[model samples]
Target: MRWIWIDRILEFKPKQSARAVKCLSLAEDFFADHFPGWPVMPGALMLEGLAQTGGILVGEANDFKEKVILAKIPKAVFHREVLAGDEIVYDVELLHLRKEGATVAGKVLVGAALAVEAEIFFAHLDQSRSQQFFGDHNFVFTGELQRILGLVREAGKRPEQS
Candidate 1:
């Protein structure tokens, strides 16, 4: 099963940045076993949320023709634990974009408190290169995510206006 950490795109700026939200619920399956009685979102999942937001922003800059993959995490820090019932807001900013890849800085906030932050690198893959490993499924999955995140219009007419 695939998991989409972000619940919605609160704001996005084509090549510059994106802001998204993820509302944690106790009903989520992972919460059952993640910590038994004391449930807190895993640090790794928080990182993935940041990566997803950054990846989508980078992919949009290229019109989604290239598959964006997280390449490296040069820096990461967690300020506090994220628990169920918390709403995490992710802010991803583009640091650099080049032919080979892109670099991004992202932060997660719970209310006014910082929860996690990281510097992420992304590699762009053309369909040819991406298909070799992901076949067509990855593209489909990404398209769905973009739609759910409101990065693309549901009618498929055009990219989000702003």
Candidate 2:
């Protein structure tokens, strides 16, 4: 099953930065096995959330022309345990964007407290090569993610109900 970790895209600035949020709940599958008595959100998943956020930012920079993939994670540090009901905000800033790859520094926050932080790197595959290797389906930024992005942006533009 394809997992879309982040719940919503709160803000996005093309080629620069983006912020996304995920609301954790007890019903999450990982909670069952992560810790039987005390459930905690896995650090790896949170990292993935950050990567996904940054990856989308990078993908949008070139209008989704190249297939973006997480190349490497130079660093990652977890400050505290993330529990169910916590809302994690992933803030990612593009450090470098090159023809072949990109890098982003990111932070995952629970409210004002920092939960995790790291540097994520992404590589852009040649369009023609990727299509041949992966059968032309964009694996990284699927329509599901893009749809959520558009919906969130549109919601932000709408007038709030009085």
Candidate 3:
């Protein structure tokens, strides 16, 4: 199955930062196998949501010319459990950007409480390399991603360009 991590953008700033939300539902398949009776969202999945948000931010900052993949997650702290019916808000900030890679700091909050936080690093790879890396992963960059990229481009544009 395809993994759709991010739900929608709550707030966004071009080349700077973004906040997005992911609502976890009881009907999700992972809950059935994660623990059976006492199902809680996994730390790794929570981190994946944060990483997805950060990837989107970094890709936007680079104008989406290159495919960005999670290279490393240096630090991750899970402070609370996330159960079904919880909405996870991910706030990601671009720390640095280079030709080959970018670094971002991200946090996952369940309501007002912190659930998970991490510093993620991403590497920009060529299209062929990305395809090889994510082989048969069934990943799709949807229209929403395009719309977000357009917004980022517009926001990054100079007054004369706009």
What tens-digit string does per-residue lDDT give for candidate 3 at 1-162? Answer: 457577777778877898988888888899998879877999998888787778777877766666777889999988989998899899999999888888999999988998888999988765445657666543334455656545545655637554
Clashes per model (N, Cα, C within 3 A): 0, 0, 0
Please report, as a residue range, the 10-residue window in candidate 2 with the lowest summed lDDT. Answer: 127-136
Clashing pairs in 3: none
Instruction: Give lDDT tens digits, candidate 2, residues 1-162.
Output: 458988899999888999999999999989999999888999999999998899889999988776888989999999999999899999999999999889999999999999999999999877325656677666767687778779788988899899
Q: Which of 2 and 3 is ahead in lDDT?
A: 2
How are the candidates ranked when ordered by TM-score, highest leading? 2, 1, 3
Measured by TM-score, how close is model 1 to the native structure?
0.84
- Model 1 off-target regions past 4 Å? 127-141, 151-162
Q: Which predicted model would earn the best TM-score?
A: 2
Which residue pairs collide in model 1, if any? none
- Cα lDDT, model 3, residue 133: 64
Higher-TM-score candidate of 1 and 2: 2
| Residues 30-148 of candidate 1: C-alpha lDDT, one tens digit per residue | 89999999889999999998998898888888777677888899999999999999999999999999877899999999989999989999886552355577654546235666776
For each candidate, the alpha-carbon lDDT, in order, equals: 0.84, 0.89, 0.79
